[model samples]
Target chain A: MTTPTSGNPRAGGGPDATGKHGRAGERGGAGRGREGDHPGQPGGAPRSLATRQAELVEALTRAKPVPEGFDAVKVAAARVALLRKRAGEVARQWPMLAAGFGDRWKASFSSWAATQPTQGSLRDGWDFARDLDGRGELPAIAGAELAEREARWSYDGSAAPRTRRGPAVRSAAGTFAVQVAGHVRIVRLSYAGTRSRKPST
Target chain B: MGAAVAVAETAYGVGIGWRPEISGFVAGLPGLRFAEVVAESVHAHGDLPDGLPALLDRGVAVVPHGVRLSLGGAEPVDPARVTHLATVAARLRAPLVSEHIAFVRAAGVEAGHLLPIPRSFEAVDAVVANVARTTAELPVPLALEPIAALFDWPDDELSEADFLTEILDRTGALLLLDVANVYANARNRGEDPLDLLNKLPLDRVAYVHVAGGAEHQGLYHDTHTDAVPQEVLDLVTELCARHRPPALILERDGDYPPAPELTAELDAIAAAAGYPAITT
Candidate 1:
C-alpha cells in the first residue's frame, strides 16, 4: 500500500531508506541525534518521527497494540473515540444503511470498522454495505440504495469512485437500479420473500 | 502572499460554524458578521453550497477552517490540499484560514479523526515544517488550532503551553484558540484550565471556538453534538477578560437543536464575552 512520491519533500532519500513505507521519507531528519531512543526497539537507535507517527496511526486504526511507554487505558479511549467519530460520519453518508441497523448502527459500524482504516466516509459506507451484501445480510430497505449507487458510479473498493459515462444497471436483494445520463431510477421486483417497503425517495 | 491581515483589525463579535444542516438558521442571524465553513466541503470550481453564497454576498467574513490538512503531520503538507485551501480562501475572500495542529493520517492510512502529536521537539519540527509549506501556498494568514485529546504522548518533552508557544512563535501563525478544547484537555488530565490559559499567548488569538461536549464513561469528550456546558461559557468569560479575541465562533457539529435554542446559545456566548448579541 506504499504510494511512491513525486516531487515530495522526502523524495531525496536518507536514513528513511531503511523504513518500509513511503511515509518513511516524510521525516525531514528532525531530532536526528536526540537522547531518548525509541521506546521498545532492541537497539538504542531512535526511530524517526515519521515511523513513530505511523506506528501510532496503525495502533489506533488497525487494532495494533498500543506502543510501549504509552498509557494503554488512555490509548484505548482514543481508539474508541476515533471509531465513534467514524461511525457518525459514515452514518451521515449512508443513511439507509445506518438506519437499517437502528440502535445498533454505532456498535455495528465500530465492530466492522475497528480494524479497517477509513477510506473516507463515502468509501467506508460503500465497502461496509458491500460486505453486508456479500454475507446476504444486507437490509431489504438498503438494497435499492446500494444498487442505485452501484449503477451511478463504479468503485473497485480501492480508489476513488468515478461516475459511469454510459448507462448502468445493478441489482441487489431483488431491487434493480438503472442509471443513464446521470439519472438513476430504482425499480424493485416484487417477490414472496421481498419486503414491500418502498425505496427511500 | 497577500497582505498579512492584522488579527486585531476586525472585531467580528460573535459567530457560528455554517453547517449545511443549519444553513437557514445561520443565514437568519441578522447581526452575524462572521462564520466558519469546513474547507473540504467547499468545492473550488463548482457552485458554492446553498446559503454560503448568500453569506458571502452579504459580506460576511467566512473563514475556511480546514479539518484534513493535517498540518502537524510528520509528512510535508500535501500541495494539492494546500492549493484547495488557498483557492477556497480566495473564493470566500476570507480574512484568514485556520487548521488544527494535529495529524489526521499517517503511513498512507487515514486516522479518520485528529490524533494527538507528541509535544517533543521533533514533533514541533515536523509541525513547523508542515506549516511553512502550507503558508507558502496560502494567500491568507493561517491560524493553527490546538485540538483536544483524551490522552497525551507519554514522552512529551515540553509542557502543553511551551509546545504550543514554540509552534506559534516558530511558524508566525495566529492561534485559533478553542475554549472547550482547553476545558476538555484540562479536565481529562486533572490540570487547571486557567493555568494553561494564563501561560498561552492569548494576544495571538485570531478568533475563538466555543463548542459543547459530554462525559462518556469517565472521560469528558469534546463532542460538538452536545449542549455547551456552563463551565465552557465561564472559560469564555475568563478568556475575554484577559484578551478578547476578534471573534468567537460557536461550533455545533450534529444533533442540532431548534433555532431558539441555538439563538440562546449564541446570546449566552455574547453575554459571556461581553459582545453584543448577534442572535437579534
Candidate 2:
C-alpha cells in the first residue's frame, strides 16, 4: 500500500497457487532480482520449468555423492558464477533503476508463469528432470535465445538449458542449435526445423 | 494512413487516465475533466509533465493513449510506435485518441500483455485494417479499449460485442468504455453482466473507464485494486444511463484511495446517472 511507484502485487507474499485466481492479484510483477553479482539481471519474471524442477529436486535431496565433476553445466556455472562477480556493481546501477513497472512488472511475470504446473521443485535434484519435464511438455520460455536468435517470450524455461545443439540434441528433439554458451530457448518442441536436432533423448 | 477512423461524436465522461503513475496525482487534481496521456508513459517521461499543456489548458481533455500499439501486430503498427503516438496526439490537443482492443507486438516480441485477438474475419479484418490505418495517421477519436480475457476464441468468429461492432462498424473509431473491462468479462465468463451489457454498442461510448477490481483467489483481478465495485458502480451507473458519457474516470492503479474515496465512487456514479452535480 505504499505509493509514488510501489506496484504492490500485495507487496510480494501470498499468490502461488497457480490459477483460477490463484493470484492474478497482479501488481507490477516480472521479478528476478536475487542472483545479483553483475550483468546477471534476468528475473523480471521467468522461473517455471516447475519452479526450476522444484529447485533441482530439493538440491538433489540433500545429497553428496556425484562429486567427481558435478555437472548440469557445473550446477548452472555455480548458479551464475556469483553474477559474474557483480559485473562492476551492475554496470554502475542499472540505468538508475529503470523507473519501475519495467514493462508492467515484466507483464505480471508472464501472467504469473501461466498459472504454473508441469511439475515443481523450483530444483534440488530436479525430480528426475521433473518427471521428464512433466512427461514431455516442457518449453515455455521467458527469455533465452540461441541458434541465430529471435525468442524472448517466457512463462518459464525454468533456469533454461535443456539441450544445446543439433544432431537431434535429445529432450525429444528434431532440430535446435545453441550457438551461445546458453541463452537456450528450446522449449522441447520438435516440429523438426533447426536441421533435425538429435543427440540422445 | 491506415485508412480513416475519425468517429468523434463528442468525447465522453470521467476520462482522466494519464499514467506516469498518475503524473503527480494529475498535478494535484483540481478541476480534472479528461485525459488519456500515456503515449508510452509520456515517451518514458523524458519531459512533458511540467504543467502538462497548462494542465490541458485548464479544462483537461488531453488524449494520446497508446501502449505498444501492436494493433493486432505482425509488424505494421510500430512505425516508431506510431510516430511517437502521432507526436503525442499532436502536442496534446487530442480530442479522442485510444488503443488496446489488444495486441502488443509479437514475433519481434514485447508481450507486455494485451494479446488476445482471434475473433476472426481474419482477426476482424486485421483489427479493421489496423484501426483503419491508425485512424489515417493519428486522426483522433481512435478509441478501442475492451480487454479481460484469460483465453478464449481459439474461434467463435465474433461476439466480443460483434467483434467490437465490426471494429466500430468498419472503422469510424471511438469507445474507451472499459467499465472494469466489461465487469472483467462478465465475471470471468459466467456471463450476464447485463448480458454482456446487452451485447454492447452502448451508443458507441467515447470514454468512461472506471477501474478497480481484484478478487483473485476467486478469479477476479481486473486489478486496478480496491474501490469501484457496487457492482462496478452499478455498471458505471448503467453506462451513464445508457451512454450519455462524455468523460468520467476514477482508475487508480493500486490503492491510493481517499480522493474522498474516489469522490464517493464518483458520487455513486452520478447518483446512478441522474447526473446533476456537474461541478468539474
Candidate 3:
C-alpha cells in the first residue's frame, strides 16, 4: 500500500526506537495530559483525545476554527453534510414540521441546528418546533402537530418527554388538541389558511 | 448459564436491515434467515416493535447492530451504552452484536455520525480498551466494523489493514466487513480495493455489509440511502471468491425504493455472493 508522503508524523505518533507505537507526546500534544480521563472530570487539565475531539466536533458543527494541520474545506463540507443528514432525520420525526418549510426546510433547519449538537431526531425536531413556536413563526400545520404532541406528552426541553397520564389540552396558533385516557383528539382547527391541517395524533 | 442454551449462532443466506419505515417489506421476506436492527432504536425492557416480535416468533435470527457506543473514544466506553446494547442483544437472543471501530462523540459532544479513527497505535489502544469494557457486559460475541472516512487525519501511523488487524488480534473480536466502505475508501484514494481485501484477515469476518452510495463533489459517499451500485456488487463477488462470509446484509437507511426495487437489490447481493435469492 502506498503511503501519503505529505502526512505529518508529529500529528500522530511516529514509529520510535522501542518499536512501541503511539507515544502520546509525539502527537504534538494532541494526547498530552489526561489522556485516558473522561471529559470534564472535575479538574481543568485538558484530556488529550477528549479535548482535540471536541475541537474537531466544534469545527464540524459550529464552523469554529479548523485545528492545526487539518484541511479547512473538508471540515466545512462535513459540517454541511452532517446538518443535511440531521435535517433528513428530523424530517422523518416531524414530517409536518418539515413540510411546513417546503424547499427551504434544509436551509432553515441547518441555520438553527448548525451550532447545536444533535439531541437525537425526536428531540431535535421538538426543540426546533418549540423554538419556532416561541418566535411566533411556526406554520399552522406544524403548530397543530406540536400542539397534539404537547397534549400527549410533557417535555421540558432538557429531559425525555413523559406521557401525560391525565387529561391535557394544548393550543398553538389557533390549533387546539386534547388528550384524555391515553387518546388525543384535535378539538379545534387552526384558521391559518389552507396549510392548517389538524394532526392525527 | 447451565449447558449454554443452543442458540442460532450462524448467520446464513441473505438478510436485510430492519427499519421501522419498511418493516412490512422486511417482514415479507420469506427466505430471510437473519436480520439486523439498530440497537439504539430498540427499547430493551419494553415490547419489541410491531413486526419485530412476529419475526422473532418465526425463529428468525435478529442481530442487534449498535451505531453508537463510541468504542474508539479516548475515554473508557460508557457503561450505560454497553448495557443498553447488551440488553437489546439479550432481548432479541441475538447470536452476536456488532459496533463500529469509530467514535461517535468526544469531549461531551455528539458528532451525530461515525467519525474515522486515526490509524495510530494510541487509537488501537483506545479501541481495544473500550471493546474489552463492552465485551465484558455483552452475553454474545462482538464484531467491529471499520467505517467509511471522508477525510484522513495527519496523525495516521499504520496502514488501515495493520490498524484493524492489530485491534481484532488484541481484542479477539470478529470483523463486520463492509464492502461498500472498502469500495468508497479505495475509489476515493485511487487504490485497488482488492489490495485492502487481500490484506485483511478474511477468516475473522463474521458477516459483510452491502450498501449503496453516490458521488458528491468528487467523493463517493456511502450514504446507504441510494441503490446498491454495480461496483459494490462486483467487489462483493471478489470478496466471496477469497472467503465467503456466512452472511451478507443490505442496509438502506432512507430514500427507500418500492418493494420490487428492494427485492432486486437483495437478489443482486445474493447472486453476487452465490447465495440463493431470498427475495424469490
Q: Which candidate is the best by DockQ?
A: 1
TM-score to native of every candidate shown? 0.90, 0.24, 0.85
Question: What TM-score would chain A of each candidate receive against the reference chain A?
Answer: 0.75, 0.17, 0.71
Better of 2 and 3 by DockQ: 3
Q: Write candidate 3's Cα lDDT for B36-87 as tens digits.
A: 9998778767667779999998888898999878898887887877888999
- Candidate 1 C-alpha lDDT tens digits along B20-41: 8999999999999999999987
Q: Whole-model lDDT for model 2 versus the true structure?
A: 0.49
RMSD for all candidates, in order, please: 6.3, 23.1, 10.3
DockQ per model, Cα: 0.34, 0.01, 0.21
**Candidate 2: which stretches are off by over 4 Å?**
A1-201, B1-13, B16-30, B36-55, B59-61, B66-68, B84-86, B93-98, B101-151, B155-177, B191-232, B235-280
Residue A198's lDDT in candidate 3: 34
DockQ of predicted candidate 1: 0.34
Task: For residue A64, give model 3's deviation from the true position in Å.
Answer: 1.6
Instruction: Output the TM-score of candidate 2.
Output: 0.24
lDDT string, candidate 2, B8-113, tens digits: 3444344456555456656666556666666654642345655676777786778776756768653356555666677778777676578887664332322334
What tens digits encode model 2's per-residue C-alpha lDDT throughout A1-201?
111112211111112112111222222233422342112224334332222222232222222122211244333322222122122122122211212224442332222222232122121112222333355522222111122122211122333223334332223212243433333335434343333223221
lDDT for A192 in candidate 1 is 34
